[model samples]
Target: MKKILMVATNVDQIGDQQTGLWLSEFVEPATEWTHAGFEVTGASIKGGKIPIDPNSYSNELPRVWDGVMEPIHDTAKLTDINPDDYDAIFFCGGHGAMLDFPNNNEISALLDHFKQNEKLIGAICHGPAAFVGNKDVNDSSIVKGIKITGYSNEEEQGTGLAEAVPFLLEDELKEAGASYESGGPEAEHVVVDQNFITGQNPQSTHRIAEIFKEHLS
Candidate 1:
């Protein structure tokens, strides 16, 4: 079976607002991947209980998804995982990712490993924040000159946290030289550029999984 490392942020706060992993962004794809027989491992920057964006859930957690929530509630430390052990690495999105994913040495190193080994790499929504300051083995920006998509400035503004986020994902991707595109606000948009796959927002999770499974096959 193929192994996939699903990385999420440990950050649970963004300013005075509540933020963490966008529940659907992580759970939806993970459920699909698991059903497809992939050994999906949930991990975070810091090993422990992963935080869920309060806005992504309601008054009660869904019991139907309890199995999927297990690893998320107790994730492994991203730094402790060996990139070589997985066929791919997927960065799940949330506002918190903008705060923690970029400039992370471990994440950069993981991206480098995946690139050098020709392994698959993916990110969704704000998850692309992981690529902001990351470079490949050649020292060029990993996203430089690639076709990619992520949470747009429009979507950020829609949440009314445009000013709160450290940086806008769409602008950062373009500034890094990526040919960024969007399927309008809150629409399903997935971009595949060689071994890299990116999704525009939470709405794109299911399609991202389908495309990712196709790539793995």
Candidate 2:
């Protein structure tokens, strides 16, 4: 089975909006990958446990919650996870991710591993914020010349967190030299660049996972 690594934020606050990995983004996508028979591992900056945003999983989206089929392992064990051991790495998103993941060395190292080993790297929503600090082993921009997209600045403003959230996802990706594109601030947008696929928001979760499986399987 293909092995996959999932990285999420352990922080569960969003200036009182209640945040972490959006359930649909993490669960729906991982479910599709796991059911396809891949081995999935969950990691957070803190390791062992990660927080789930209560608002992300509502009765409005039952399939996503039900689809999440397994327990997540400690991410700190990822120090031993070679990119060669996993088919791809997925960074799930939520508003809280913007607060916790950007400056994390662990996340940056994982991205570096994928780049060096030529493995897939996937992310959704503000999860792309984790990419803000990932540099290629050679010290050049890693996502340079790479087509990508994530939660747009407009969406951030839409959420009324342009100031509350510390950084801007689209602006940071552009600053990093990624060839960014999106569904134009829409909720269900997804972008794929070879082994790197990104979902625009929680609504884009399942489709993003399907895109990942289609390539890996």
Candidate 3:
């Protein structure tokens, strides 16, 4: 069976606000992948108890708390992961990702391994933060001159945590030399550039999954 490594943030705090992995960001795609018969493993910078963004829950969500609990609660530490064992690495987003994803040695090395091997890599919303400081096998910035997208600055500002995040995602991605693309806020936008896939916001999760499914096939 094919294996996929799904990553989420362990960070639960953003200044005085509580923030972690956004539920729909992880849930929507994860469900799609699993239903398609992929063996998915969850991991984090820290090994256990993946935090959930309190704001992502509602009366309408399918209540997948039990289905995803095992992986989320027993996450593998990013440093302990072996990129070669999986077909892809998918980063799920939230404000927490901004705290630990960028310029992180473990994540950088993991991403580098995937890029060097030409394996599929994907992220949605703030999840693209994991690509920061990563380079391809040729030693050029992985995002340099590549097409990508993520949660925009305006969207972040709309959440009222703009100042809480370490950096503005849109600006940071452009500065990293990515030809960033977007459909603005609240729009579903997914950009697939070779093996690198990124989505613009929560609304884009299903589309990201579709792209990943096509890549896997």
| lDDT winner | 1
lDDT of 3 by residue, 15-70 (tens): 99999999888878778888789888999988898889989887666865449556
What is the number of residue pairs that collide in model 2? 0
Q: Number of the top candidate by TM-score? A: 1
Model 2 per-residue lDDT tens digits across residues 1-217: 8888887777778775767767667777777887899988877766666677776655476654463534443454445656667778988888878887776666777788887777889999988888886676686666888899899988888888788787788999999899988787666777877668888877788788888898888
Residue-level lDDT tens digits of model 1 in 1-217: 9999999998999989999999988888888888889989999889899999999989887676678877798899987999879999999999999999988888888999987787899999999999998787677888787899999989999999998899888898898888999999999999999789999999999999999988886
TM-score against truth, every candidate: 0.96, 0.90, 0.94
Between candidates 1 and 2, the lDDT winner: 1
lDDT agreement with native, every candidate? 0.90, 0.78, 0.87
RMSD of candidates 1 onward, in order: 1.2, 2.2, 1.6
| TM-score-based ranking | 1, 3, 2
Assess the local accuracy of residue 217 in candidate 3 as a C-alpha lDDT between 0 and 100: 71
Q: Which stretches of candidate 2 lie over 4 Å from their true place?
A: 59-69, 73-77
- Kindly report which residue stretches of model 3 are placed more than 4 angstroms away from their true locations once superposed: 59-66, 136-139
